[model samples]
Target: MATDAAQPSLLLPEAGGGLLAALDIGGTKIAGALVDGGGTVRRRARRPTPAGGDTAVLGAALDVLTELTTHQEWRSVAALGIGSAGPVDIAAGTVSPVNIPAWRGFPIVERVRAHPAVAGLPVVLCGDAVAMTAAEHWIGAARGYRNALCMVVSTGVGAGLVLDNAVRSGPTGNAGHLGHITVDLLGEPCVCGSRGCVEQLASGTSITRHAVAQGWQPDEGPADAAAVAVSARRGHPVALAAFDSAARALAAGIAAVATLVEIEVAVIGGGVAEAADVLFPPLRDHLAGYATLPFAAGVRVERAALRGDAGLVGAAAIAGAATAGAR
Candidate 1:
């Protein structure tokens, strides 16, 4: 477990009083945090997800909660929130993440609510992308945007939306699944049973695969997206082309969202966005071509202000909202 007492705080004047307990569950890690109304992380814990059966995954999540329960501030927690990798059914209180195959339609909400430490506290569940959107809208780059698209472009592409100044989670909590949107009429197939999906072209995994296929080799490390970014920085043509291809696909998808919702901005985050120098320039160039409509032409692209703590902060934001609605 790791704790950061000096973590910078986000100003949320309307956050009200009390603390929110948050859990961010993904393929790699299961993290928990006690966040104050002002968006400051007061306490935190994490556990690496084990590659085992369903019980093992649930056990790891419970362990994180147990660690958090030891904190003195746990007593003041007003609600508990969970943000898990999709596809989650908020109405059903279940999650079916692709990476965690052992947990199809897992009853996460009931299990978490059953915890002794969480006794009687309201619990909220949402897809990880939706949580990221909430975090961005609450205190990150989308703070003042009435309509925006926030994306995570890591191993895969995931996204959520902020519409009319509020996170729109739609039915089932997996509203903004931009990755599965077909961008190319004849592109690669996606694991989501779709052909020519944006994720097949724009994800970090796709970027690395494309760079490697184009004969771009790393100097002294794995042939991943970061290595490709490094090579692009050194003027490697193949690496640059790889990033440009990804940028183009992302541009297509972003333009589609802008056209459909008339979003004013698109806030991008995740591992791929870290290579901003190589990605953004080409992305902006391509976006200008696709988003040619009068309203869509004004769409702005910005990097997400929040990073590692986005999930926890976002979970807290939704939990806070749920708490307020219940009263």
Candidate 2:
């Protein structure tokens, strides 16, 4: 268990250095950043994700913290926040990520708090989408909007909802798993044991699958979405079609969410979002077809302005806000 000072200060406030350490745990990488109270990243580091086991992942996180705090200028970290892949048990400080089997039932919060460098710091946990949404609200695309949705499209699709100036973390902190939504009852299987999920049809992985099915052979055989995007730009018909499939699938998910929540804007992020023109135009067109209701119409679809660090920054925001609330 974390020490008293490290506990969430929901009732009592403490005045001290407000440096916050934020970590974003992804399937392929573990990214960390040291953020000041004002939400500026002071230092950043990353490591290829460890596939061996959860312990190895924790080791990598500790190694990152050691590197960041060892630098003389960053010793005043006041809290730690982790924005991790869901579904996470925020109250329990545990994670059972659907994609990372090794993380099932892992006590991530305790493991992180046990680190010597940050043992006495308040710690908060949130799903990646929610954290990213918080980051966007703080300094990214949703900067001025109190009601918005931040969605990420990469290896998989996920989202975070913000309404009335607060992130809706929902019960168990897995509120925004848009990727798992069923887009096609006959689609491919997802890592979550679901068939025909939005991720199965629209994720980068799906783009690769569609391209392969179209008989577009890559130099090394089956290629990922990024490779397909490059091929599409270079006049590969199959690749272009794959992009269209992904856009349509994603648009379906976005339309569903937009119609349900009526958010003011939906900020899309993640690796695949880099193919902005190839992806967004199709998404907008597809969405326009389905957004017939007045409430859902006029919902803007924009790119996430936080770049790749949105998760980390959002984690810091969660921790900072939680700590302040505890105060």
Candidate 3:
């Protein structure tokens, strides 16, 4: 396992040699950035993710990276960090993202290291959730919290843990996969081979699906989470119920995390979180009912502070930490 001499900043002691090249890979898009110790993106690029096949997926990521290298600041890059959709095995540096079907146990680290422009740079790989945790701990909402759960509830659910002031990825770099944790023992079967996982209820895609199935029609149109949120705001019964149910499921998962790991806070982000008025109230309500133990009762829930760049920032944080530790 890799370790960093983490402080509030979570950067190396020297802190001046170079920037970090960070990649955030997901089903919809591949993003790359040049970031520094201060969580600033000096250069950035993005491309549509080609979920068609293994080569297309990797090529999209490479396209972003190649464009990033063209930036004059590329010379200052110290190391590379990838926060990917996973099932990532840090021990093996392989990834099998459920969303990216073509890449099963893909050897990402070796492939990235083989890239000509980045040949000698160290590559650190972790789940997107783990990277999100690192970002929150270093420069966002969870920065001052000694123990917290950082989650991204978007098209799918992703999360990570910060324990005793350090980002923890567990053995497989998939520790805080709150999405897959079973909330309903016998509810709908999920893509992760589980029944009633938090993702099955709380993710934006799931929320929209549930809303549509419940006959929540958007006069504006049927689209996605945004449509659901708009309908929920209008007090549509089915849409409201959909949000409430998802909130409850998320609360169950969050409570489980708090009860089991004893976190002081839960930091939430992503598309689903945008419906804060609809989501947070019921989330806290259900959370109260579930997190009954004195130890877990006081866990605070808050929105993410990093906004759109959390994943990229988190990736950069991991890269900064790993390269610093190596030095």
Candidate 4:
């Protein structure tokens, strides 16, 4: 595991009081952080996720929590918040992330609460995409927006919505699952049993897959999305086409969200968003074509201000909200 501390910032001023213990659990890593009310990360720990059974995954998360307890500021933690890859049932306090197959309806909240150090503290849970949305609304690109869509386009695509100035996670904590929305009516089927879902075309994994299928070879390094991005920057037709395809799908999905809910802006993040030069120009162009309605036409797409720290900060924001509600 690795640990670090961050400099203080004046973000999330309303998040004053005690600190919040936050956990961001994903296929790649299990991260924990102690965040102050002002959204500054006081201390953090991270560990690679084990590719094992349910017990192993739980153990990894528990280990992150154990390390967090060793911090001097742990005593100031008011509540524990968790953001996990989903589909999660916030009401049931369970999670079933697609990538972590061993955990179907895993009792995440119960297990976290069972931790001795977590005793008596309020526990909050939400989908990772929703957590990102919370962070954006609190201090990132969507800070002042009353309505917005926040997305993460990594190995997979995920999204969350903010409506009327609040995160709208919906009943199953999966409201803004824009990836599963069909963009190509007769396109290839998705793992979610849907045809032409945005994730199948817009995710980093998909971008690489599309590029490779189109005969785009990398100059060096592994043939991943980053490599494809390099090729796109070099003006490779196949690589450029792959990114344009992803941007088109993303534009379709974003436009759908805007048309349906009238979101003022779309804040996009995750690994794929790093290819801003290749992704944004095409995305903007495609969005203009799809979002033709007067209200939807004003929707702006912006890169997420908070990068990697969005998950931890967002989890802390959820914890802060839970603590405030309890008070």
Q: Number of the top candidate by lDDT?
A: 4
Q: Estimated TM-score per prediction?
A: 0.91, 0.91, 0.94, 0.92
Best by TM-score: 3
Model 4 ranges with Cα > 4 A deviation:
1-17
lDDT of 1: 0.86
Compose the digit string of candidate 4's lDDT tens values, residues 109-223: 9999999999999899989999999998888888878888999888778899988777889999999999889999999988777889999999888999999998888999999
Candidate closer to the true structure by TM-score (higher is better), 3 or 4: 3
Superpose all Cα atoms of candidate 3 onto the true structure and report the RMSD in Å to 1 decimal: 3.2
* Candidate models: Cα lDDT each: 0.86, 0.80, 0.86, 0.88
For each of the candidates, the C-alpha root-mean-square deviation to the true structure, in angstroms, is 5.4, 5.9, 3.2, 5.4
Which residues of candidate 3, in runs, are more than 4 Å off?
Answer: 1-9
Worst 10 residues of 4 by lDDT: 1-10
Q: State the lDDT at 253 in candidate 4.
A: 96
Clashing pairs in 2: 9-326, 9-327, 10-326, 11-326, 12-327
- Provide the lDDT at 148 for model 2: 81
Q: Give one clash count per candidate, in the order shown.
A: 0, 5, 0, 1
For model 1, what is the error of residue 10's alpha carbon versus the real structure, in angstroms, after optimal superposition? 12
